[model samples]
Target: MSGSDETSQARALGEALATLRRERGLSQAEAGARIGMTSQGWGLYEAGKRSNLFRPDVQRRLTGALDATPEALVLQMGGEPASPEALPATGLSARGRVFDGAPLQTRRLRLETDELAPWASAGTVLEYVPGRWPRRGQGCVIQIDDGAQRVRLYDRADDAEVVVLGAGGLDRTERIARSRIQSMSAVTARFDDE
Candidate 1:
C-alpha cells in the first residue's frame, strides 16, 4: 500500500481501538499497559500520528490486550477478511485472572446502594460470582460470618485478618478464624457515571 494508505489504515485501527477501550471502561494507561505501551504511546496511536501500523508483533499484542481477534483488528485497520476464531474472547472467564485466577462460577447478581456504604453505591451495578478465598491482600467480594455480611474482602495476612472495604468507605476488619467463608468472587463490574 502507499504511505498515505498505510496512515489511513493506522488511523482507522486506532479509532477502533480507542472505541473498544472506552466501551470496556479501560483507561488509556491500563490499555497501554496491556499492550506493552505507555499511555502516551497509545494516545499517539489513537491520534493516528504513528506511521508504523503493520508491525506484526504490535498487532498481536494489541489483539491480545484488547481481547479482540486478530481478524477483528485487521478489519478495524481496513484490511482483508479474517476468521472469527482469529478474534480473542473478552469474556469474564478470560479476564478473571485479575482476581488471582479465581473461577467466577456463580450467576451474575446486580446490587445498588444509595450511599457508597460497603463498596460502590447507587449509580453502579456489581457482578457477584461465588468462589473460594482469593490470595490474601488481593481484593475480592466475600460472604463473611455465615453469609451475614457480603462486602469487598481484602486480606491482610500480616495481621492475620480479613478487612472489608465497604461502600461509602466503611471498613470492617475481622480475625481470620476458620469460620465458613461461603465463597469469594470479584466485583467485576461497577458504574460510577453518577
Candidate 2:
C-alpha cells in the first residue's frame, strides 16, 4: 500500500482498538498495564503513531488484552476502508453540545492528590467540557459552593444529589447535595505521566 493508504489503515485500526478498550471500561493506563505496557506505549497504538497494526501478532496481543479477538478488531474497523472524514478525531470525542448556537469550551485540570486513585492518580491531567453531563462510570469534576473542587467517578444523580465513587473504591459511594454544587462538568480525557 502507498504511505497515505498505510496511514489511513493504521488510523482506522487505532480507532477500532480505542473503541474496544472503552467498551471494556478501561483507561489507557489500565488497559496497557494489563499487557505490561506503558500508557504512552499503548496510546501510540491508539493514536496511530505505531506502525504495527498490520502485524497479526501485534493485533492479537492488543485485542487479547481487552478480552477480545483480532477478528473482532477487524470487524470493528468495518468491512471496507474508512473515508478521511470518517476517521476518529485526534483527541477525546466532543461531549458538550452547542448552546444557543454557541460552542462550549474544553478545559483542563491537574490532580493534586490521589483522591481517586486507580482511576486517576496525582499528577494526572484531565480534560473536561463544561456543559457536558457525565455518564455513569465516567469522570467528573464537581465544584462546590464552598469553592472546593473534587474529581470523582460519576455514579448516578437524583433530583437532590449527585452520586460518585470515592478513592476507597467502587463500594465507597458518596452523594453530594445538588444545592451545594457550583458547577459540574464531565471529564473527557485523562493524561497520566509517562
The lDDT values for all models are: 0.52, 0.75
Please report the candidate that would top lDDT against the real structure: 2
TM-scores vs. true structure, each candidate: 0.46, 0.47
Please write out the lDDT profile of model 1 over residues 1-194, one tens digit for every residue.
57786666667777866765664445677667754689998888777676554454565666555555555555444454434444334210011112232344644444445433434555555554454333333345656666554555454322123445443454445554434554445555554545
Candidate 1 regions with alpha-carbon error over 4 angstroms: 75-80, 83-117, 120-194
**With candidate 2 superimposed using the best TM-score fit, by how many Å does residue 150's alpha carbon deviate from the native?**
0.7
Per-model root-mean-square deviation over C-alphas: 11.6, 13.4
Superpose all Cα atoms of candidate 1 onto the true structure and report the RMSD in Å to 1 decimal.
Answer: 11.6
Error of 2 at 130 (Å): 1.0
- Kindly give the stretch of ten consecutive residues in candidate 1 with the minimal lDDT sum: 90-99
Give, for candidate 2, the lowest lDDT window spanning 10 residues.
90-99
Give Cα distance to truth, residue 88, candidate 1, Å: 21
